[model samples]
Target: QPANKVFPHFVPSLSGFSLTSEVKTQDVEYDVPKANSTDGKDEVLFGAEKGWLGTPIDELNRMPQCAPPLSHLKVVPNHTVTVRTDLLREGEVPVPYPTKFKDAWDDVSVKMPCSEKNLFPMETEDGGGVQSRWELIHTALQGGFKKRSHLTILLLQCLFFPTLSSLQCLELCEAQHLFEVVLPAMVSLALSAPRLCTLPIPLLKSRMNHSLTMSQEQIACLLANAFFCTFPRRNSRKSEYCNYPEINFYRLFEGSSSRKIEKLKTLLCYFRRVSQIRPKGLVTFTRQMVNNPPNWESSQTQLTRLHITCEGTIEDDGYGMLQVDFANRFVGGGVTGHGLVQEEIRFLINPELIVSRLFTEAMEYNECLIITGTEQYSKYSGYAESYKWKESHTDETDDWQRRCTEIVAIDALKFRHFLEQFLPEKMVRELNKAYCGFFRSNTNSKHLSAVATGNWGCGAFGGDTRLKALIQLMAAAEAGRDMAYFTFGDAQLMRDVHEIHTFLTGRKVTVGRLYSLLNQYSSTVCKNCRTTRPDESLYSFIYQKVSSQTATDALKVISDGTDTKNLW
Candidate 1:
C-alpha cells in the first residue's frame, strides 16, 4: 500500500447543465501551503518552487459553480422525480460524494465552507504572497473541482516533461492524481455539456506511477494503434560479445576543460566542464563532464552504444568517455524515459524480456551491441589509446561507440497532434452513433452491447496497442496518460469496437444518485433549441417505455437508474 493511487468517480459533460436537487446553501473557503521552516544553513537557501506553487487568488477557483440547474421536485406516486429544469440554476457541478463508487481514493469533506482564506491560512514573509494546501484538496473534493486541484494538475503536466534532460531527478509523488482524475473529465465535460451527452476516455500515468490526462505520444498511439512501446532497432544475433575500444589520450583534449591543470604533476587536474548534448530525438541525454573522481586507483569503463568524438584526434589527448546517472535509471522512478528504455533493454528473441512492440518485427535484422573495459596504472601512464595504438604498430582508429553516432534523425513530429485530434474524436463519433441507435424510440440495437467493455490489444482493459511507442517519445512527466487509458478503457472495452458511446451507454450505470439524476433526461428538452435529448439513447427509450409502465413498475427505481438532464 506504499504505492500511490488515484480513483476517478466522475467525468463531467461540458454542456454545463445539472440534475434536479434541493439546493443546499453554504459559504466557501480554501487551503494553501506557505513558507515555514528555515534551512539553518549559513545563509538561508530557497528555491523558486516555493514562490510559484504555494497559493494565489488564481488558484482558489477550484470550487464548482455555486448554483447550477437542478432536476427535481416533480415526483409522481411511483417515486420517479420528473425533472423540471426551467426553474433550475445555471452551471453547477457538485463535488462528487460517492457512497458506492467502488473505491474513492482521497479523503472527502462537505460540512464546511470551501476557501483558502479561512482554510489553512498563511501569508508570505513580506505579506506579499499567500498559499493554500487546503484549497488544493477542497478543489477535488465532494464536488467535481476546487481551484487548487486545477493548479496541482497544471504543475504536474509541466514537470511530467522537461525539454532539458533525460535525467529526471525530482520526487513529486503526491500531485499525480490531483491532475489525473480531472483531465479527461474536464476535457469531455467541456465537449459534451451542450450536446446532452459526452464521450469518455481514460487518463494515463506518467513515470511517477500517478495518473495524468494525456501526453502527445500517448494521444497519437491511442489514436490509431500506429505506435507502441519502442524505438527502432535490430535484434541481437547469437551470443556474441561486443568489442568497442577504450578511450585514448587524444580524445581527452577534445573534451571541455573546466578542471584546470596544476603544477608539473598533479594527477589529472586535466578535465573540463561537461557539455550537454542536445539529442535530436525525444529524450535528450545531458552528459555532465566531471573531473574523474579518485576511486582508490581503480579504473572502470561502461560500454556505451554511442558517443561523439572530434575528427582526426589522436589517442594521447588526455580524455576519457564515461556514463553517469545510471543509478537513477536502474532504480524505479517516474515514466520519463520508460517508453524508450522502460522495458528490459534486451533482445526480444531471448524471450526473457518483453519485446518492444515497435521493434518486434524489425529486430529480426541489423542487430547492434556495445563492448567496453578500463585499466589503471600506479605511475604516469600516457593517454590510454596512445599506448594501444603504439603497441599495435598499426594506424587504425579504435573508435566504435563514438563512430556509431550518425546524422540520421527519426521523424515523429506528427505523432502528438495526430493523437490529440484523432483519439478523442474517434471515440466521440463512435459513442455518438451508439447513443443515436438506442434512444430514438424508433431504433435500439442489442448488437451494440459489447461496447460496455472489451479489449483492443494485450492489456487487461480495452488495451490500446499503439500508445506504448508513441508515449515513449513524449517527455516523461506527461506520459502517465497510459495508466488512465488502461483504467477507463474504451466503452465496449476496445473489442469489436473501441469508441466512446459503445462503451458508456452499453454498461449499466452503477452509481445510485447519478442514475437518479440521469433518469430525468427522458422528457428533458433543450430550452434554446426545443430538441429533447437524454444522457443516452437507450436510457431515453427505456424511460419512455417505463414512464408508460408507471402504473406497474416502480418509477422511482427506474428514474434512479437514469441520468439527470440538467446538462445543457
Candidate 2:
C-alpha cells in the first residue's frame, strides 16, 4: 500500500486567502522568439560601429543558419545577417509570450504570430487568446542565469511585485517610508485579516483615519509599471581603441528609462513582507520559497555555448605580427540549449518546491542538474526513480539524466579533423604563399606563419576540444567564402554539439524535396592533392576543368542537418 494512501497529505488553510487560488485577471504582453507567420515591412539597417536597431526583429533582416565553410575559406556575415543575443536556433521552437500590446512599447506591436521581436503586447488577433502576464512574468522569472535565480527573481520583483509578507528569504522593511499615506492602510488591512502577518501595522492605523481604495494586486502592478527602470553600463574606452564603442550586453535595461538602477533596487523591498513585528522594536520575516530542500544533485546542470569570433594573432614570419589585439567583449549569443527549463524559471520555486521541480523538470528534459535541489531529493530518497537507480526499466527521464552529464563534457577531436581539410598539400609552402602577412595566434610558430594564434586564455570553464576545432575552422574559414558547408553523419552528436551545426548548418534554410540542399565553397579542391582553388565556381565541370582537378567525388560531409539551404 502507498504511504500517501494511508496517511493522506495535510492540506494548508486557504480560508484566510492564498495567492495560489486567487483569480485576478492577468495582463498579457511579451512575445516569444521567431513566431511571426505573415511578413511585415522590413527595415534596411546600416552597418556602423554599433549594431542595427529596428522595430521588429522577426521580419526585418532576420538571419538563417548556414553551412560552415571549409577551414581555408573565411566565413563572413552579409547585409542580410542579423545576430542578436535573443537568437532562435534549429530544433528550438518559439512560443509567444501572451501579453497585450497596450502593455508596452511604442513603435511595434504584436498581432497574429509573434516572437521576442516586438515589445507592445496586445490581445491575440486569433481572438479568445489564452495569453497571460503571469505566464510571461513567471516564465522569464524561472530562467536562471549562471545558475543564479536570485538575480532574475530580484529583477522581476523590482519590476512587477509590490508589498507581500515575505519572498523566499528577503526581509520586508516595515519602518514605514510613507508614514502618513501607508500607516492607516496597513492597520485597516490587518484588522480585516488578523491571520495576515504581512500588513504593516502603521499602515492599518492610517487606513482607519483615511480611505484607501486600491487592492494589493492593483497597487503593486501600478507601482511596478510607474517605476520601470534600467541600469546600463557606460560605453568603455576599449571601443575607442578599436573600430567601435565598447558595449556591454548583459546590463539590465527597463524600457526607455536606462538610468534608474538604485531606485529599482529600493523598490524590491516592497515585495517582501515581515512575518512578525515586536512591540519593543523587533521585526520577524518568513521565507516564501519552493518546498524543496537544497542539495548537491538538484542544482547541477550542463551548458553549451556556441561562440563564433575572429581568431589570428599579432605575430607572423612575413609581416612581423598580425597585430589584432583581442578583448573579451562578450557578444553574439545563440540559444544553444532548451530555453525554458534550462533558463530562468528555476529561480521562482518556493523553497520547499525547488527540489521536486528540479528533479521533475530534469526528468522531463532527460537531464538532471547537479543542483542542491536535485541532490537533496536524491540523497533523501536514495535515487529510487533515477535512471542511474537501474533496477527498473529506463524511462526517458533516467536516460536523459544519465546522458546530460556525459553530453556536457567536451570532445577535442571532431572539429580538428574538419580543420585538416583546409591545410595545403605542402604545409610550409602554403603558409609562405597563401596566408596574409597577418595571423591571429602563434603559440606554435614553427608550423603556421600566421600571427595572433597564441592563446590569450581568459575563459574559466573547461574546453571542449571539438568546440575548439569548430572555432578553428570558423576562424580560418572566414576570409574568402560568402558561404560554407560542413557535412557529417546524421546523428544527435552531429546536432547537440551546437556550435558546429549552428554556424555550419542552422539558419539560412529552405526545405526542399528529399534531395538535401547544396553547399557552395566558392572554389574547388583537388581530390588527389586536396588543393583548394581560390576562384569561385557554380558547377563541378567548370571548377575542375579550369582548376585542372581530378574527378574524385569525395564525400561532402555536411555537418548541417539534411533540412537546410543558404544563399551566399
Candidate 3:
C-alpha cells in the first residue's frame, strides 16, 4: 500500500523538504507578557513571561465546589467517616465542630491506632518492662518525652531497627528532633483523628468525578495517622488496598540509605512546621474523568500561546499556573518506598498531597487528579540519589478559596520496549490522557490558566521528549489554554520546541492537522525497527512537512476528516 493510502490526506508534496515563501524562517519575536502586579499595575520583570509570581491566582477560575458542605455532616453508605458525629450535633440540628473529639472505632470508621482497644502490650529489653501502644502514645501526648523514653526507644525500634538487627539510621541530633519535636506534634495531631475526619470521605474511584475537601488540620491528622502506621489493610499487596497506593510511613522509615534519611528530614521538617502553627485554609482533591474523549484527528482547535524556557522548575517558576505532576498510575508512586522521582518529590515537598493515595485508586488512561490549595513547606535541591533537603519554605502565595496551589496528576504509559511508544494507539492514548488533565469547562474557559508542565513521561518511562511535548501542546490547545513548558535546563530543547511552536503558530496550524501528521509519523517510525534517528525525528519530520507544505495542503488533511478505522 502507498504511504498516503495508509494515512490518507497526510502525504507531503513530492517537491521535498524546504522552507518555502509561505513559511517564514526569520527569528520570530516571542511575546513576553507581563504579570498582573500586586499594586494594581502590570509589572514586567527583566525576563518575565506568562507564568510569573505577580500574576494573581484569584483572577483565574473560581474554586471547585466542595462536597458535604463544611457546615453539615453526611456519611454515605459503605464509606468510612473517621470523626465522631454525635459530638457535632446541637439540639437535633447538625453543626460542624471539627475540634470536638470522641473515640468511635466501629465498623464504619477508620480504625484508630491510638485507641486503647487496638493497642497491645510489648515487652522491654530489661526482661520485665512492658508498655502498651496506647500508654506510649498517651505519654507522648502528655509531653512526658525524655532523652531515652520508652516511646522514643519504641519508635527507633520500629523505624531504624525493624528487624531488630540493622544498624541505627538516625544521627544524635536527628533522633533528638524526632523525639522532642516531630513525635510530639505527630502524636498531638493523631489525637484529633476522631474530630478531624467528620464525614466519610468518598473514595476517588477509577471512573468517577468526585471531589474531597477538608481543612489543612484534617489532612494533618490523617498524615499523622499514616506516620504512626495506623491506617488498616494498607501494608500488604494482598489486602483490600491492593488497588490503592501505600499510605503507611513504614517503608520510608524501614530503609537505611542516605536518600531515605534525607527524605525523612524533609518529612520531619513538615511535622515541626505544622506543629508550630496548623494551617487553617482548605485543600481539595478532585478526580476528573472524561466520558467522551476528543476526536484527535478531526478537531480543528488552534495552538494556544506558549512560554518555553530552559531555566526553573515546575514548582518554582510555574506558580500561578496549573502545574502538572508527572505521576505513576498508583498516584504517589514510591514516596512510601525508596522511589523518589518527579511525582514523589512533589509529594514530599507538599506532604498534604500524599493523603490522596489513601482514597485515589490506580488511575485510568482517561482520568486525572487535580489537587488545589496545597502549600509547599520544604525546599530541596538535586534530583534522585543526590537529593538533599534544604531549609523550610514559607509559602507566601495568595489563596483562591483558601487554596494556594493547583496541581494535576497525570500518569503516562510506561513502555518496556522503546519502540512501543511509536505505535499510533500509544500516541493517541497519551494525547487523550493529556487532554483529560488539561480540559476545562466552557464556563471556566475565560479563566482557563496556562498549563505549567515539562518532559512528562520522558525519563524512566522511555518516552521521547519531543513527542511528549508536542502531545501536551496539542492537548492544551484543544482544551483552549496556553502553556508554560519548563525544559528543566535543556536549552537546546527549549529553543527547538519554541522554534517549532513559533513556526506552527505563525502558519496558523490547527490541532487536527498536527494530529494527522503525528499519526503519519508514528506509522513511519513503527515500520522501521530502529529508534528515531536525528534526521527522522518527530521534530525534524514536522519541520520538513509543515514548512514545505502549503496552508491548503494542511487544510485538506483536516477537511478530508479522520479515518475512523485508524482512530484509537
Best by TM-score: 3
Report how far off residue 224 is in candidate 1 (Å): 28
User: Which candidate would rank higher by TM-score, 1 or 2?
Assistant: 2
Tell me, by lDDT, which candidate is best: 3
In candidate 2 the C-alpha lDDT for residue 61 amounts to 14
Model 3 quality (TM-score)? 0.75
Supply the global lDDT for candidate 3.
0.68
What is the per-residue lDDT of model 2 for residues 1-568, given as tens digits with 9 covering 90 to 100? 1211100111112121111212243332222122111122332322222121222222211011111221221113211111111332222221111222223222111111112221334567675444443334334433433222444454555344332212222212222222222322322322222121122111111001111111222222222322221111112334211221212112223321211221121122232221112111111111111122112122221111121112111111112212121111111011111111111111111111121110011111111111111100110101111111001011111111110000010011112333242333222222221122122122232322122221211122222333333333233332221111111121222222222233223222211100011111212333323433323322333333422322121112234333223222
Across residues 419-491, which tens digit of lDDT does each residue of candidate 3 receive? 6786889999999999999986653455666788999999999998888989999999888777788887665
Better of 1 and 3 by lDDT: 3
What TM-score would each prediction reach against the true structure?
Answer: 0.14, 0.18, 0.75
Which of the two, 1 or 2, has more lDDT? 2
- Angstrom error of the Cα, residue 342, model 3: value is 1.0
Q: Point out the worst 10-residue segment of candidate 2 by lDDT.
A: 402-411
- TM-score ranking from best candidate downward: 3, 2, 1
**Superposed Cα deviation of residue 49, candidate 1 (Å):** 43
Q: Report residue 301 deviation for candidate 2 (angstroms).
A: 25
Candidate 2: RMSD over Cα atoms? 27.2
Model 2 error, position 452 (Å): 33
